[model samples]
Target: MTTSEIWQPPSEFAEQCRELYGLTCPPRWGTPRRPEYPSLGPKAWKVMERLGFPPMPWQRYVLDVALEIDPATGLFAYREVGLSVSRQQGKTQQILGVQVHRAMAWARQNIVYAAQTRGMARQRWEDEFLATLDDSSLAGKYRARKSNGHEAIIWRKTRSKMGITANTEKAGHGPPLDLGVIDEAFAHEDDRLEQAFSPAMLTRPMGQLWWASAGGTDKSAWLNKKRAAGREIVERLWAEGVHPRIAYFEWFAPDDLPRDDPATWRMCLPALGFTVTEATIRAELEKLDPGEFDRAYLNRTRKSTPPQDPNVPVAAWQGLADPVSQAGPELAFAVEVSQDRAWSSIALAAAREDGRVHLELVDRRPGTDWVIPAVVRLRELWDPVAVAVAASGSPSASLIDGLIAAGVTAPEDKERPRRGDLVVMRSGDLVEACGQMADAINQGTAVHRDQAELTAAVSGARTRPSGDAWTLDRRRSLADVGPFYAVTLARWALVSRAEAGRDDYDPLDSVY
Candidate 1:
């Protein structure tokens, strides 16, 4: 059978297939020749249509993959089915339809629907499954237990029940489940819940586990790992015509695509224009932060982990942009070099008359050679109070020789000290500077003129613990957060000088 012989697909779905990325399966139209086996997909589709829940072509295609039978055993080939697509693309409706079929067609197919929270799982039960049952001919044939202690839908004829459970190790412990629908699988960080539930399905020969979710962060280790495993198997299926027992279906945009681009959004969202409108998506995007919109709607995962609580929120950094480029009399400079020594950045902080700290990324260049010359030139022009350097094992250590060559001197005696033009900050002092930067942002005292590089660094910055204290985790950050560190150090120098009440602060006499 050819696509022309099949019914015309919905315009939105057709568009989605055209732009799809992260593919690792036999695409709907490109399913290769395989062994003869009876498929329940068409039967399921007909049942859904009879119940007035006619599925889209893409939905039907996913059903085919999930329902594919093994030629040898006359049962489903795949024991696990994973569907990862954007929200508002009718995933809930599809899952509800599949469960309904199992409840009606199969005898005693005990199923469980699980979500991140019990309330969410219960809500989906009442809203979609129950609503569909009520509308269909199966209404009076089933008994509903909607209470807290007893939440299930029991088919009066077959005595099979579809239960709801939260994503916890204790959930669905006693029940012998034939099918488990894991809703919001992206929210799961580990497989403890799945491990707990697996015992229920172990004895059943036809047991199936279905996972449906939008893309989540790298913190969702279990889902990400499963997806990767499924992808590897699917790739083999596409290449060698050998199908694995795990059915994985994913619809997402390429990583290089811009989140705001309509093409990227269209690729991930199969129900666009029908269930979700562009205007609604744009409005919701306006309300969300950088990664939130992409994660929820675009089905794009964050490539790396960010700290649980960041030193500065991306929104606060975005809010503190002040367009003034003027530098006040009190100026300080800070330099940051990437741990890999591939890049370095110079930042300047000025104490404005309004008592606000103005920050800017003065320069960023490859290698450490240009860094010293750039710093020296900036110092000569601005006559800064101090050039601060975080004496980390990497960047600061390498900068010591460069500073000496630039004629910037550091104090030899730390015990009885006056600050020199070069301030070599180490240990607790560097951590204090990080905290001070966060304070300035929270108090609305820190301002910037808004450079793209600086904004990205601020958004990507995450923290790591140094004993009881925390410092920026540059390695975990998606990009170099050097600009953020540099500016924070510069801000500390100016604020510390002011706090000491040193009016005639010699470049070499102020305390660090």
Candidate 2:
């Protein structure tokens, strides 16, 4: 086929691609609408054929991008490539094809394949890498060495080899690396090992780094950070701008899609029809937790591990539910925002006639932009005793000036004496409020109207240590706990006022 002719997939593979949901990065900053020619796919296909596994269309597309060369420099255009798909989508097969082609066809030297653990690295090398090479047509042409600290394959002619090592800061040293593969990239907590591994590739003219992973914990800070950066680049491309250096591909259902939807399953699992049948996916979904299924099969990063023991027990929180809404005279309000500024909630805690606090979610909305206005509207309606807002460590921190502008401020602020309606919950007070909320739930002193969103937030509330105390851990929770925190702050403000030797204070009457 000529370079000008559009490359067509094999008949079987084309049929499979038609049946699947596939997505790929359009192209690097300034590239053709479609690849003109593939420098790597043909070579990689030969080895896949030898191994009795052919390249899927999606896999072939990845190879074309990974090896796409710059016309002027004759070097790869994208040096860093990220491949994230649901588990069992034949990522290992794709990885194997690339490494083999690099070793045999390109005769590349000093390549390292690292896994999260030594045992995992060894198992992959033994079960897949060595088994493929040993069983292939080129078995007699290569040498496989398995020693205590040394596991590698050597090309007999050029002595070019691929080394297998555990992911460690010390592992990527020694030889100048031509290519690096980080398998299960999501398991890496930080980029320290990657940072150390990268310098070896700096001097190579054709150096490349490929990251492959199934989605991991939401706490995979490093991986999430890179994913965010990759998304920004894609956005820039959509805005008619370009990021020349990086290529990112994700095979996953959109986060908002129904997890059990067949289309969503097919979208994330490119090999659903081939390696895994629809029946198999259904069975897997039935067997796994929703969060686990989201992470493993849907290729989503979620809070996989719920706190060992949450601040509020499910039973305890359920016990506090009063389905019949109650209203009390002395009402206080609190506003809280998610750490990422994605969602915010305002909750009210009213002092009940029975001395217990009755909580209710007043308003919950996306983004911080609506928070100040919502607070102002609630103030006008209820004339709340105080509106507790986080002074630090919250998206609401930015709302302080806005609240003050709307005549809400601290009582001690003489400059804004007419606007002393906002009670700033500092970091120390925030921690105390969280503990207090937990205590009230345990003691059944905090009753709630049993709102679904608030219940979910309460159920997912996990505590994180903050100095001598602990606060709600929003990041590790399954859902946004802003509602939970908002209620807590409101309750604390209401009770704190009553305990401060102000028995005659009727906050509702005073405010109204």
Candidate 3:
């Protein structure tokens, strides 16, 4: 299509954040009148097909994102859908087009491109931003402009401007940001990295625009916290209360990607659309040496095996409930801590039929500080029942003492054998204990509160290099407890009072 053939350009439009975001706002900056383009329907699709995209949700989502203009709200409406796809996908074109559209249609508007690193961030403008200008109606928006590498594109217009920068823990200040794009966001740490930079974009009266990458593996901190926060945010905004509108786009291994067929690769990346073909599939399968591909692509996380023997195959554990609804004394619980700073697990195996055990609940939490509170709570409810806690180190020991003093547990003077023991290690015991426990769980003896994390750890755990074994990826699974956490609970519960008070056992923390 000729330049003149393209949609008409407003005599003087601006890229202020409000218009770009499609929000209703008083135009205090940039051009005033709300700019109009054909709804991102037929025409956008025609070009996308020409550009090699199949009719996938991403393409449709991209159009919807482009058509949406709400700087006052719903920057999320754009960000959520745009950033969840692969590297060569069309999002790069989408951001570049949006920036150009804003610059051409709005005046004195600020646009900044950001990435985790400065060099990577600059590449957006060089590859996508500049290329779109070369092919579009935007090439003539400025009489004087410079291709400022990846840093930015500067317009000489006294009325409107566009730029780019990488977001740092420090803000990318100097100009009021109307539009911002974050590339490969899954790589960004979750710990409020965006929060520090986001506020700066809203400095403009029109508000700000944001789009980022899918999250990554930084579990204990970043995305892990955000995953929790995202849940709360969604519940608050969409479920119970009202907050700003937010959006989420996720593409990952499905819950059912079978571990049996390590090559069950097709199940995970369904968003591949027209990109994944028979040839592509065959080639990827061919390239990978079985084990590496399974862990890397399938996301199979390995358990943190004990140093002596990691593969200690754990037998099944089951959770058997009492036939009679209400029975037994107040129950005592024992929890174990893993050596990894990132993981510690607590198990609550309760009394059942004749000498057999059932795990009422289990949690593979992270860190000692995390382990203590739950222990303290369990100790409180089962007061007279001595709490058998793993006495790993000073942190763990202090918590035990703290519990006794704080009335969460029976006094120390009353301590006895079955009540608590470090469950001191025997070289072969770790695996044996895990096997015994796994047997209890598999046969319905032990049950987990949130099976997602526990099952993820169990299934993900696998064989590693020779002599060394699969240790849980604390970075990935919460169930990274070296053998201490899972086994300790079982050992503690087996010796508790069956005839004494065990009725008030609360299964709150262990069950979803």
The number of the candidate with the highest TM-score is: 2
* Model 1 lDDT tens row, 98-139: 787778778888889988788888887998788887998667
lDDT of 3: 0.44
TM-score for each candidate, following the candidate numbering = 0.58, 0.61, 0.47
lDDT of candidate 3 over 67-109, digit per residue (tens): 5456555232333223343333345655555555555445777
Looking at model 2, the pairs that clash are none
Better of 1 and 3 by TM-score: 1
Q: Considering summed lDDT, which 10 consecutive residues are worst modelled in model 2? A: 1-10
Write out the backbone clash pairs for model 1.
none
lDDT of each residue in 33-112, candidate 2, tens digit only: 22453366567777787866776656766676667776767777778888877788788988887887888766658778
Q: What is the C-alpha lDDT of each candidate?
A: 0.74, 0.74, 0.44
Alpha-carbon runs more than 4 Å astray in model 1: 1-36, 239-241, 302-477, 480-512
